[model samples]
Target: MYRQILVHPEDRNLQRILWRTSGDEPVKEFQLNTVTYGLSCAPYLAIQTLHQLASDEEDQFPKGAAVIRRDTYVDDILTGADTLEEARDIREQLTHLCAAAQWIEQR
Candidate 1:
């Protein structure tokens, strides 16, 4: 089973840049200026980010790869796989993704 990971967006600090021309509009892109997603108080922000990433990656593999995410008071991730290898692979990827975030097993 995949680890119930708790990722924090603060691990990567956010930065805002103001670059606007006299006749140009302003656009912004969130810049992750910190580590990974495990070094802040609000861990759910990072969890949300990971959830989107997982969703995007769900179709990459044909196996039974279901990335489950629960964000109540915190972030909870449960990855479903038909085989142990697939499960373990998902867990490994999650660990790597949150290499800087705080994560532990559900049970």
Candidate 2:
């Protein structure tokens, strides 16, 4: 999720990822190049991504950011409306908001 947020080029080296497929293989070292899961700061990084996207005025929806900040948890987005049309509209709005941030809605 941290990969979702853009990081400064200067700071990218700080997020270097070093690993190997197997013990017999030589250790490989490379920069993350993007935020990723499991880093100690990943949750904060993901929240930053959400905050940055939600704060954009051009893509703001009625109570949309509030809903995301308050309702979202562990990748689940929980929302509904009194009517199907309203629900669908919210869905579309949310989808557009994510798309604007380069996150394609999967499903």
For all candidates in order, the CA lDDT equals 0.46, 0.70
lDDT of 1 by residue, 1-107 (tens): 02333324564244434455554676554654433334463365544645554564456532212443432224555446689987787776655544422332222
Q: How many Å off is the CA of 2 in candidate 2?
A: 3.7
> Would you list the clashing residue pairs of candidate 1?
8-37, 38-101
The runs of at least 3 residues in candidate 2 whose Cα sits more than 4 Å from the true structure, single-residue gaps closed, are: 19-28, 58-60, 103-107
Model 2 lDDT per residue over 29-67, tens place: 888667667877777777766766677733467556666
Q: Total clashing residue pairs per candidate?
A: 2, 2
| Candidate 1 residue runs with Cα over 4 Å from true position | 1-32, 35-41, 62-65, 68-107
Predicted structure 1, TM vs. truth? 0.33
